[model samples]
Target chain A: MKKYKCIVVKSQTYAKKAEKVLSHNGISSSVLHCKAGSVSGCGRCVKVEEKDVDRSVDILKKEGVILTGEIYGL
Target chain B: MDYKKTVYLDNAASSFPKPRSVIERMNRVLNENTANPGRSGHRLSLSASQIVFDARTVVADFFGISGHEENVVFTYNATYAINTVLRGLLRRGDHVIISDIEHNSVLRPLVAMKKDGISFDIAETFESDDLTVSSFSSHIRNNTKMIFVSHASNVSGAILPLKALGDLCKKNGILFCVDASQTAGHLPINIREMNISALCAPGHKSLMGPQGTGVIVISPELNTEISPLVYGGTGTDSLLDIQPYVLPEYLESGTLNTVGIAGLAEGIRFCMNEKNAISSKISSLFSYAYSELEKIPHIRLFSPKTDNVGIISFSVDGIDSEQITRFLDSEGICVRGGFHCSALFHKKALSDRFGLVRVSPGVFNTKKDIFTFIISIKRLKK
Candidate 1:
């Protein structure tokens, strides 16, 4: 039972686009409250399992989603 | 080492590389006089009010409105100016006639007021050919209290025939309001000759001024009293809690964008000084781009083939406008995509997709930039 939290940096519009890209790749994830330490404000963040983090990042990058910084572990 | 340069082709949205004078004047205003315009009798306040008055004169002269500094009311933006006129004038059971190419700024407010019993009709534009004034005259009804139209299409850069439509409005005795958001600085607009009762313009776009600066030029004939959108202190009627019943002070409540107004005055001066040169340059660029774009297969152009302001809208086959824009962005070419706030016009034009790629050049743009753009589009085709 591993849990991983992914921080989505960017606008809600971009976050929604990222969510669709992840779902299209058959990845399951839940968005969490956006934490600061990035570009300020609650833009959006996604929480996923520790193991699936690497695969999700790869998919997002390939789909042209700009990821600023990511936080691991909830 | 030259850095990765970015080319701005979004002048229609708002101009970039504003004239040196515009920037200089704005900086001067910020440093010197930052007081509330027309509020106090002190030197700083008087200086600030003078700057705003200068801007008012520039607008009045540019638009051919007959008035002193009092008639030009400062607004937040063209949208606010339009909302002021539409909401202020239109009453229950009154009707308005507008063009299909109106921006959401005009349409949204009118639509919201529709619930209050105001009705409106849209005149269809000739998408295949040039839209003429005759097409507009047919839509006017006896109940039509006002006729509003955009001077140019934000989506296609198609210039409307304002003078002809103005004549028609004059003959029928309908109050004409023009939204000059896309054409005010780039094109020559004479409010009197056009029979425009109210002219609304944004200083940020073609005027090359800072944002939050807008103007509403009221004609002499329009006697209808317009209530202030936001009532507070107009500096004129300090004693009365009610908004003052005057020319500009009636509508302009609270502090104005003085720094932006200073910049606008410079921008307008630059426009007047280099009117022919700038317009010819923009016209040539449009022609060049249109000819170059026509050579590329599967690229559908939305703008007319004739010369116009530095604006163009087109679409590539089987490619989404957003994706093309992204590709262009990667190449350091800036362009605008999506509906361009004219969904109704898009629907009427039946543009293959819901949106089009808009390329609007500015005074700073050169032939080399347009050449690079054409080359980029050609490469994208391959």
Candidate 2:
């Protein structure tokens, strides 16, 4: 069983941007389609390693990415 | 006849001899990745989607809408972008204001919207920025919802006062929309600095991109209010049965022109790298052409002496404007003639009968080309 954390964003655009920001901040991340009823409302979300969740959120926040929901485990 | 010998001066219509990077980028994309962006999760689709996102970022940065790249919506051309902004933003009984020098793209949509109870008034532009701003201010009504004007005239090459107009709109609480067809790459436009709500421009003009690519950059405040002009699938929220409320995907429907956008991105990059030089080079060429054309006997120059966006509008004393252009074409010197699809401008300038010949030089053009154009027009005097 793989453990990962996801940060939901408004759309794929933000997801991709967040991915870039995280990569620049030394965090490895990938964008994934959010499941229905996710905080993003079926848009795309950025998934990252569970260890890098807090740092990734902080990086995206500092970069002004509108984070909709909390970090949820998947 | 060797094609290289011919000079291209119709850049205001569409830039010719696109930047080599733009061409090479488009070719590379078409050869490598033709997948629809954001339509699939596969590697190729993701690559295509990244290309679009990269282009959107470049466009946003170019227009000073950085960090809000999602607000940059891809359309087919400035016409479609203008239609989307005009139709989507204005509702019944909403009065809009436009400049007299608008292309048919802005004029026709507002004309059609009249049937839907939306009305628009044209504010006359003048050589003086103060008078031009005052004219636009005078047309503002209580019901005025938006003030849409061209950043520069396509006919007379008259550059409008965008900052003052943007300030006027801000003071009046009216949305400012600009048609940047003639000045996108030729001028520096910052959406935030200009207080622009919607900025529309084609990629093929000063941006030096291929045809079939344009952008509609929206302010964040108008994101939710401006509805999608075209609705279909955005690859997200598929099961919802309604268009998803996303930033770009909200306004952007259908598959985007990936190859053209890739080319557009490279084009914008080229503009960014040459930003310091593009304006000065084009200005020098415009000055040279203006001085040389003013020297031609029987030539009537319509373009302003200064503050032009690299276009020279002129007419001959006896011959028709189209006839002059036709003659120039025979000499392998390309230039646009006649109304230039700007009847209102011609009517206002009182040149509707003879139209006007427009010689718009691009960044690729040289003083020698303008000299060739001058000598060709000189031949017409004989």
Candidate 3:
């Protein structure tokens, strides 16, 4: 199991769309139903590697995935 | 002796007892594929994303919204989908035309938009396609930007001449949008042949999906760009301060109900599998219910005499709609009472009162159910 960082969003739809954008671009990530809302407002989040956070977030934003907050996963 | 069994007749509202596949699919997603879609780079996330995409394809194809899957945008509900089209497409000073018997979903949005400088005219629905089309044509003006209508009336079970309206709009270069909340899963709607610009529907109703899921299928030829109603993290364009100007994202904002959508996809699949059987079943039931109800004296059928969807609205002589509904409720029959939430329909339906009892059947219903329902209504007359 690879340690991953999490980017959370309120909308499960956005979360799903964001995952597709990252995958289409060859980014490694997974969606989770964790308490990332403690960091972001949404309960749904996508997990990426900590080192890949900046790259993933940038691409997601550029692709128009609405994000709330990004946090390092435990 | 009256059997103690609950009969559901409010399929016009959120459908009851969603197909087994719908529930199973939803549970599988929640338990196994619980990844936050699209935002992830992991396998689970990607698979989850696939689920959402597949759902879009299912809905898009279901309505004949061809070309791309992204053209089908999901919303919170049909009302939200309608608002996305109304609030997004219509600008200030734009005018709209609609059928007289529209659900509150259309009327309420137009009302809210009125203050913003947009106006609307209501076209009376007629038995003849030419008459209905002319009724809408008579309201067309230089400023008329769109013709919006419910594909089938929730109150009257009246099916609109959507194909005719679509043709009229194409000839005039005006946009045509339909609220298919009542008909999406029940009947076939091909966006291309109909020349419709947008078709909005709820996943919960005819789609046989869960509540809180809806979709707006856009035609590829549509030139006008509609804005989204809600805004937040799209997961793709996280860094952009403005919402993404893309196919689905352009109209969608914030987190969506993925579980609901997963359920909706299965619901649509269930409908597709049983399409012929379901349609014929509804047709048979409608005809039977209509003929049976007509035989009972004092029952006034408000629905048009022509072919209709499963929805049937009527009032009994000297009996309040709610009172009749209550009597039926006590007999283990469930039907909608009151105005069904459309003030305009109510105004046209019962000027003396605010509501009518509506008996809407679903694919799951049996002929016996309608028979029991008729017996309950006959009891009211006695």
Candidate 4:
């Protein structure tokens, strides 16, 4: 079983954007629904392999994608 | 109705015969799936969400929004977008500056907001860029928070100095907004380059998209300041009692017109493919029409000779503009008549007595169409 890390974002818009930017940077990511109580307002997060988490987040942040919460293992 | 026989000169209102891609894309969306975007996590819903996101990207790139694609908020039309910015960003004590030639969309909302303690001043527009900038400068007050103006007059097609106005706003530390009702897609506009804090435009007009589609692109500086005019379920924030503070979803509350937005993306792509050729064609047609229309004895042209957006407003010495429009309609020529929902422009032009006849040429129009329109107008009785 391959574990993944979820990066919570502001909304679905940002999740999708982050997913696109990460893909462009050769890091594959998928958008998933954030579980209850994981985030306060936005309920969407971009999921990536645990190994690719740091690179994916750096790409998203540099591209102006707003990440709402800390990364959590899923 | 023989469609091909009639010439359409009302492109400024709502462009006819949208790009085949727009129609095809819209039909494809309607036929395939009409699922709501940003809702369920199912395949159909995700596809719909992708379609809307793609549109936001295209619109954002087209308007120089750069990386902040979520800043694009879809609405019903330019009026709705303008109202959103006007009502969303403006507070009770904040004053706004608008141009004298603004459409009723901008004027009426500011007037209505007056009762709410918000105030606005009208800046006179002149043919010279210096005089126009000076006029806007003279109207700026200590409380002037935003300067909202149309990129061009919908009636006279007079193009305003957007870059100059943007610079003035930057100097004054005021937020700048544009109502690109007539100039969007027809003219080149970069929100970043123009220092525009917010831009409002209808996708149906120069954008060549289906009706019921419009966009308001906000800069990062003014994003949180603008409150949502309509608030409801935003998919992600449904668990909360109040609306989400996130962008786009924050402003877009109801179900979006997925099909319209799908077509709007194609429409913007069509404009991008056509490039400067579109403006060139409109300018050529306008010049031809102006040269011919001025030849008529009683015709008085109101549009600027140069730097116009392909719109020509004219009137006979003694005949009502609507009467001439009716005559042209009888000749199978289509044009707009009356006040054009611009009371200030009409009042300023002193054509309020009977209004002016307006003909706006689009990229699809030709010199022959202008000649036909000119011939039809020449046949009118004074």
Question: lDDT tens digits, residues B249-365, model 4?
Answer: 888988999999999899999999997899789888998998988888878999999989889999899888898889999998889999999999999999999899999988888
Please, what are the lDDT tens digits per residue for candidate 1 over residues A1-74?
67677756343323444555687788886544354443343334666677887888888777655566766567
Sliding window of 10 residues with minimal summed lDDT for model 1 chain B? B235-244
TM-score of chain B of each: 0.96, 0.98, 0.96, 0.98
TM-score winner, 3 or 4: 4
Would candidate 2 be rated incorrect, acceptable, medium or high by CAPRI criteria? acceptable
Worst 10 residues of 2 chain B by lDDT: B219-228
CAPRI band of model 1? Answer: incorrect
What candidate 2 gets wrong by more than 4 Å, as runs, is: A35-42, A58-74, B221-224
- 2 against 4, candidate with superior TM-score: 4
The candidate scoring highest on lDDT is 4
TM-score of 1: 0.81
Give lDDT: candidate 3, residue A64.
Answer: 57
Q: What is the lDDT of candidate 4?
A: 0.90
Give the candidate order by descending DockQ: 4, 2, 3, 1
Regions of candidate 3 where Cα sits further than 4 Å from its true position: A1-74, B1-4, B351-354
Which candidate leads in TM-score? 4
Ranking by TM-score: 4, 2, 3, 1
Write the number of the candidate with greater lDDT, choosing between 1 and 2.
2
Residue B272 miss distance in model 2 (angstroms):
1.2
Q: How well is each residue in A9-39 modelled by candidate 2, as lDDT tens digits?
A: 7666777889888988888888876766765
Task: Give the distance in Å from residue B180's predicted Cα in candidate 2 to where it truly belongs.
Answer: 0.6
